[model samples]
Target: YNIHPSEKLIQAFRKKPYQGCCPIQAEFLFIGLDANYAYDIEEQKIFPKVIEYHKDAISFWKKYNVHHPFLLDGYKGDGRKYHKEFSKIRLTCEDSSRISFIELLHLPTTGRNNLRNTDLDKNHLKYIHQAIVSQYTKAVFISDAVFRLMKKTSTFSWMQDAREIEGYSLKVFHETSPLIYKHLHFSTYGKFQAQKEKEMKAIHMIISKI
Candidate 1:
């Protein structure tokens, strides 16, 4: 399937508070906090250009049948740990092609702790909602932080049932339209190594139902 972002969605991404790439539409959406690469105000002036660059990259990969850079293994850099964890979840899925990702905050920082604030504008939340509704998103794996943020904003207020999975929570919006799973931030997996396997099992259980 050659899924593409709509022009309106692309505009939403362009006007995001921070610099980041637009997510591809897919069945599974992974929501995170923010990126690790920070750009100065001057550099951020070209955010529109950066968005176009990412759009072009997505088009090139789709045309060549190459894996999305976000799904590639052996990545090295600030977000390597998070990338590794995402790879594990991707592997757990029966069809990796159905997965894609987006960040609640487009701002890039070396660490969440370093960020002065996490306040987001309406556009950021709209971008995520659009990403979900635009595709046949069957499931969403959200980082604990992002999940909490959504809860505070009542973004998933319609979701009334949540099933606990080894400390994590899996919420089903309906019979199976979209299953929202909340787990610890992927970057902190190293600190909770003891529960890694259990979390993976929980993730597998969720995917099995998908």
Candidate 2:
């Protein structure tokens, strides 16, 4: 019932989280990223900066052992599988892999950010989101100045009006919007990300011109 990782893993995970323009879940930061032509300059504005890895949260992650999606909010296992196959990496206890897994799963975008009926299968999509998001992980790009400006924000009222927000975006952007809730329940991971990039590029292009 527990993932008793070696003390080495605990120490390894204690390392700090990267700070910068949180590309993931950073809805407003993208606006800044477009203005600077570089992520470095724009990421400073957002409050409660995103952490590279929630080290303390790691213990909670291990508490679940088998991933069931509801990681922090309520620990409710909805019966649908989360394919935490990726989490297995953290169990290795080797510093390299434990740290690497952090980069691999920046933050699971599927469950918390976007969710559909528990009836839907996400085993395949989880694998895809992990790969695309990890490519630009913070350990590689964030600077001390950036980290200095960032602080971890609390996850409060994050899902306040799920349907209204989800529906509005879906209505306006249709399938192209970056609203993961639109696709998490219906589209392929590649399609969702591709549209996300498109939306990002479109916004950046518009903002940079002004």
> Which runs of model 2 end up more than 4 angstroms from their true locations?
1-9, 17-155, 158-188, 202-210
Q: Which is the leading candidate under lDDT? A: 1
Q: Assess the local accuracy of residue 133 in candidate 1 as a C-alpha lDDT between 0 and 100.
A: 65
Please write out the lDDT profile of model 1 over residues 48-147, one tens digit for every residue: 4334435554453444333233334323345556655655653522344455657665544443332213365566677677766665676777755665
What residue runs in model 1 are displaced by over 4 Å at the alpha carbon? 1-24, 38-53, 56-76, 90-97, 113-118, 154-162, 165-176, 201-210
Give one digit per residue, the lDDT tens place, for model 2 in 67-132: 222223323222122223223223322222222221222212212222222322243224323322
Reference-based TM-score, model 1:
0.60
RMSD of each: 7.9, 18.3
TM-score of 2: 0.21
lDDT of each: 0.51, 0.25
lDDT of 2 at 128: 25
Predicted model with the maximum TM-score: 1
